[model samples]
Target: MEENIYNNTYSLLKLIREKKPLVHHITNYVTINDCANIVLAIGASPIMADAVEEVEEIVSLASALVINMGTLSKEHVEAMLVAGKKANELGIPVILDPVGVGATAFRKKGAEKIIKEVKLAVIRGNMSEIKSISGISVKSKGIDASERDIIQNDNLEYGKDISEELALKLNCVIAITGVVDIISGEGKTVFIDKGHKMLSTVTGTGCMCTSLIGAYCAVSRSYFEAAIAGILTMDLAGEKAYKNLKTIDEGSGSFKMKLMDSIFNFNHLLKNIILR
Candidate 1:
């Protein structure tokens, strides 16, 4: 099963590179550039269009839509609804990153509204954000996840339980990313533990993961497997980039560039060496 999963993930990576799927993003302005670059790094094209006038048309041309509520406005919310509905109608995948839910009522409302309206293929967030969206009593500090609410070794079982429950409830894959990532869907769960702590120091890494998931889902049929592939790609790249930084004696800024470089140069040969 492990080998099969590895092969499937490798195939998805190849497909994304070959297909170069168009990923439409109505994402936060803060991370919009990073999201676009990350999409390109993973061998997908990204189009950021939140205009209500052209969002539907843009979504129609794309293979996947990513709705990120990191920096929300009324106009962005409307665009998300329009694009999400259009993506649903076109049978394209939609990935939602409820970026700062539980931090503010406005963010919580916007996240809930999107989830209620769109048939999401995958929902990605940190622990507090996921718990808040799942209706659990958790608090978030601005866009950052609460450290206390983070899943620890002792709470692995509980984390799996909540992740599976949320996946069942939403009828989609739910990925809670942090020190460890828990991806659950269709009553099955997987834990990806191949990331670097430097990822937390970087902004928009979660949003980048969402865009990467959009790329994978664009070509893959299984949302669950696609999501796992996306998370693994980001985490593995982070691991490699951090090692590169250590070798060169650089900081987070250099690590960010190396991360993208790692993604762009990533291949099955490196996958076998890094993914185990």
Candidate 2:
């Protein structure tokens, strides 16, 4: 099983590079640049076009569509719907990042509307946001996951239950990312314990994860595997970035740079290391 994951990820990364699939993003301004950069780092193309006038046109040219609710606004929400409907009509895979859906009624309402309308291939979010959207009562800390909602060893089954329930309900893959990333589909659940706490300190890691998922989904047949690959790429790179930390004074700023570097260099890393 572990080997299958590594091989599948390698194949997806190689396919992404070969195809250079364009990923259309109707995302927030807070992490728009980082979201674009990470998609490029992972060997895919990104276009950030949220204006309603051209959103559907851009999404038509894209291999995958990403809908993010980071900087939630009524106008952007409309654009997201337009793009998502177009993608669905064309059979293009769509990934949703329900950023802070648990934080406010507006965010929650917008997210629910998207799910109710768009046929998402995958729904990626933190524990709190996923729980809240699943109709499970949860506590949220602004845009972050509440400490109480995070998945841990003691609550692993509980986390899986929520993830699977949401995935089954939405008929899409559900990925809850945090200290213990849980990705659940119709019949399978994957847990990734490969991230660093420093990952949370960064501003756009969650958005970046969604971008990665979009990239993989563009070239992969399995949305579930694509979600796992997306989350694994970020988690492994984050863990590697922290491992490569050198100076004592290096903070989250430096760590962010290294994190991007690790992602950009992961293709090269695979060249030298044997998967077996």
**Top candidate when judged by TM-score against the true structure:** 2
Model 1 RMSD in Å is: 1.6
Candidates in order have lDDT scores of 0.89, 0.91
Candidate 2 positional error at 14, Å = 0.3
lDDT by residue (1-276, candidate 1, tens digit) is 556666777889899989999999999989999999999988999999999999999999999999999889999999999999999999999999998889889988998899999999999998888899989988678888887877667677888888999999989999988787899997799987778998988889999999999999999999999999898889888998888876555888999998999888777545766467
User: TM-scores of the models, in the given order?
Assistant: 0.96, 0.97
Query: Number of backbone collisions per candidate, in order?
Result: 0, 0
- lDDT, residue 182, model 2: 95
Measured by lDDT, the strongest candidate is: 2
Alpha carbon lDDT at 7, candidate 1: 78
TM-score of model 1 relative to the true fold? 0.96
Model 1 residue 217 CA deviation in Å: 0.4
Clashing pairs in 2: none
- lDDT value, residue 69 of candidate 1: 93
